[model samples]
Target: MKLLLFDFDGTLADTLPICIASFQEAFLQVDGVEWSEEEIEDILGPPETEILRTYTKHGDPEEAVECFYETYASLHPKVTADPAILEMLSALREAGFFLGIITGKARRGLDYSLRQLNMEGVVDWTIAGDETERAKPDPECVDRALQQFRTSKEETMILGDTDADIGAGQNAGITACAVNWLPGFTPKPLTLTPDAVFRSPEELRFWLYRQENPLDG
Candidate 1:
C-alpha cells in the first residue's frame, strides 16, 4: 500500500485504562452519571464531546470535554506505544509510504500522543475526531486522510484494533487490517471480516515490509 492510515487509542497506544477512568470522572463531575467500564468501551472510539453528550443532563459538552482531557492528560505518563511499532513506522516512512492517522481522539489528545510517542515525523497527516462530523464506522475521516495523501483507495490500507476502523476503511473502499493486540478486549475483529488481521506489531511489520523488501524472500 502507498498509504497507511492508523487508529490511535487501542491500536497505537495502551490508553484503555486512562480513557475509561477519564470518562467515568467526566460523567460523574459533569452530570453525576456513573459510567461502567463496559459502557465506556462501547463508545470508546469517538470524540470526547460525543461521548459526554450522551450522559449529559444539564451540563455543557465543552465543559465535560475539558474535564475529560484534564484527567486524560494527567495520565499521559501511563500511556505508551511499542518501540518496535515506532521503528516500523520510521522504516515505512523511509520506504516512501505516506503514513497518517485516522483516529477518534480529539486534536489535543492526538497531538499529545504524537509528541509523547515521537510520531510527528512518521505521521505525515492526521484527521482527528473533531475534524469530521462522522467518526469511525463512517468513511469521512478515512476519506479525508486519503485526500490529504492524494492516494486512491486501492493503494491505501487502514490498521486498527477495532471493527469500527475496519468498517471505516471498508466504507472508504480500501483494505482494512484488524489488529488483535489487546487481549482483554472481547469480540475479536476476525468476526468483523477485516481484509487482514494481525496479532502483533512484529507480524504486521514483517508482512508489510515483505511486499517491498527483497531480502524477505
Candidate 2:
C-alpha cells in the first residue's frame, strides 16, 4: 500500500495497561468511583477530555483530565513498543509508503507516548481523536488521513488492534488489517470483518512484502 495508518494504543505500543490504570486512578480520584478495566475500556474511543466530561460525576472534568494526564505520564516509563515495530516502520518508509496514525487518543496523550517510546518523527501524519469531528467507527479520522496524504482507498491500509479501527477502515473503503500480537488483548465482537488478520509484526511485514513482490511470492 502507498499509505498505512496505524492505531496507537495496543497496536503500536503496549500502553494499554497504563491507560487503564490512569483512567481508573482519575475516576477514583475525581468521582470517588473505582472503575474496572472493562468499564474504562468501554468508554474509550473519545478524547480524554470528552470522556472525563461525560463520566466524571463529583469533580470538574477538566481537573480530572489533568489528573489523568499526570497519571499517564508518571506510568509512562513502563510503556514500550514491540521490539520489531520500529524496524517494520522503517522498512515501510524505505519502501516509499507514507505512514500515519489514526487514534482515539487525544493529541496530548499520543504525543507524550510517542516521545516516551522514542517514536517522534516516525510517522508522516497523525490524526488524533480531538482532531476529528467523530472517532473511529465513523471513518472521519481515516478520511482525514487519506485527504491529507492524497491517497486513494485502494492504495491505503489501516492496521490496528480493535474493531473500531477495522470498522473505520472498512467504512472508509480501505484495507483493514487486524494485528493481535498484544497479550491479554481480547477485542470486542467485530461488527465488520477485517480484510486480513495478523498475529505478529513479522507476519504482517512478510504479507506486505509478498503483496509488493507478487512475482517473487
Candidate 3:
C-alpha cells in the first residue's frame, strides 16, 4: 500500500485506562452520574461530544465535554506508546509509505498524545475528530486523510483495533486491518471480520513489510 492510516487510542497507544478514567470523572463531575465499566466501554470509539450526549443529564454537554478534556489532559501523561508500534511506524516511513492518522480523538488530545509519544515525524498527516464533521464509523475522517495523502482507495490500508475503525475503513473503500494488540483489554465481540487481523505488533510489522515487497514472499 502507498498510504497507511492508523487509529490512535488502542491501535497505536495504550490509553484505555486514562480514557476510561477521564470519561467517568467528567460525567461524575458534570452530571453527577457514575458509569460502570461496561457503560464506558460501550460508548468508546465515538467523539467525546457524542459520548457525552449519550450520558449527560444536563441541557448541554459543553461543560461535561470541557471536564472530560481537562481530565484527559491531566491523565494523558500516564499513557504510553507501544515500542513495537513506534518501531513499525519508523520502518514504514523508511520504506516510503505515506503514513497518516484518522482518529476520533480531538486535535488537542491527539496532539498531546503525539507530542508525549514523540511521534512528530512518524505520521505525514493527521485528521482528528474536531477536524471532520463526522468521526469514525463514518467515512469523512478517512476520506479527509485520503485527500490529504492524494492516494487512491485501493492503494491505502487502515489499521486499527475497533469495529468502528474497520467499518470506517471499509466505508472509505480501503482495506481494514484489525489489530488485537492492546494489553489486558479484550473487545466484546471477538469475531469482528475485518479484511485482515493481526494479533501483535510484530505480526503487523511483518505483514506491512510483506505488503512493501509482495514478490519476495
lDDT of each: 0.81, 0.88, 0.82
Candidate 3: list runs displaced more than 4 Å.
Answer: none
Question: Order of candidates by lDDT, top first?
Answer: 2, 3, 1
Prediction 3 TM-score vs. true = 0.90
Clashing pairs in 1: none
Across 1-217, the per-residue lDDT of candidate 1 in tens digits comes to 7999988787777776888899899888987889898888777767776778766777887789899989988987876677767877787788788888888887888887778766676778888898899878899998888778789898899999787899898888998988866544443334478887887777877787776685866
Candidate 1 vs candidate 2, TM-score winner: 2
Best by TM-score: 2
Candidate with top lDDT is 2
Superposed model 1: Cα runs more than 4 Å off: 182-190, 212-216
TM-score of 2: 0.95
lDDT of 3: 0.82
Residue 200, model 3: lDDT of 84
Clashes of 1: 0
Candidate 3 per-residue lDDT, tens place, 89-200, comes to 8887887989998998877778878888887778898888877887778999888888888999999999888888888988889999988787765655534579888888
Residue 138, model 3, lDDT: 91
User: Which of the two, 1 or 3, has more lDDT?
Assistant: 3
lDDT of 2 at 46: 88
Report the poorest 10 consecutive residues by lDDT, candidate 3: 184-193
